[model samples]
Target: MPTVPPTPSPEVITYTVRAGDALAKIAAQFGTTVEEIVEANEIEDANRIEVGQVLVIPQGAEIPILCPILWPLTMAPTRC
Candidate 1:
């Protein structure tokens, strides 16, 4: 049997860039990171985003926040 790669989850969100918008701010609003956005969009320059540019925000890509109380219970970390 031929093996097939699993499709990525359709959890991406589209965001249009507005005037004075920066990757850092967008990432914060979407609970993601600038690095993830840059990687997802193949951005050549982090400092050079234009207005009205469409960006794909990958959901659940941010590093999870580890809870001290739950640290010993499971390997999975909870969202911050």
Candidate 2:
């Protein structure tokens, strides 16, 4: 039998919490959701993030593209 390589892992984005950083702001900045951040980090409190704390932000879905594939009939979403 031949040895096969492992599958590729999903891209991970890490963010360090700042003094004025909030989950909602962070989520909006990263195009993700606060719920996702909480879930990913298993956060007990949404407003308990500390300064310099690193967080794993999950970004899986591709941004919608808004390029027109066909006129009138179809509209392709453009990546933001």
Candidate 3:
């Protein structure tokens, strides 16, 4: 019998609140909806988040951010 490979777990991202960041915008940036973030964070109200709050961005389903390379030209075409 052949062994099967296990699926990888989703990764979580975090974002800090800026001076003018709203829940809707934050969700949009993560390709999700504000309601989803609220539900994930157990926020009772969607409009009551405070500034400088460190919210756990539920980007489990979204693509990860690629780090900037010091030598962009050295990167493979497929990676670029």
Name the best candidate (by lDDT): 1
Give the clashing residue pairs of candidate 2, or none.
Answer: 65-77, 65-78, 65-79, 66-77, 66-78
The lDDT-based order of candidates, best leading, equals 1, 2, 3
Candidate 1 Cα errors over 4 Å, as ranges: 1-9, 61-80
On TM-score, the leading prediction is 3
| Candidate 3 RMSD to the correct structure | 4.1
Give the higher-lDDT candidate: 2 or 3.
2
Candidates 1 and 3, the one with greater lDDT: 1
Q: Which stretches of candidate 2 lie over 4 Å from their true place?
A: 1-8, 61-80
lDDT of 2 by residue, 1-80 (tens): 99999989877778899999999988877788899999999999998999999998876733433554554654666443
TM-score of every model versus the real structure: 0.61, 0.62, 0.65
- TM-score of predicted structure 1: 0.61
- In candidate 3, what are the lDDT values of residues 45-74, reduced to their tens digit? 888888988888775646446666665465
Lowest summed lDDT across 10 adjacent residues in model 3 is found at 71-80
Q: After superposition, how far is residue 76 of candidate 3 from its true place, in Å?
A: 13
Better of 1 and 2 by lDDT: 1
Query: Which tens-of-lDDT digit does each residue in 1-80 have in candidate 1?
Result: 99999997766578899998999998987788899999999999999999999998876755334455754577776654
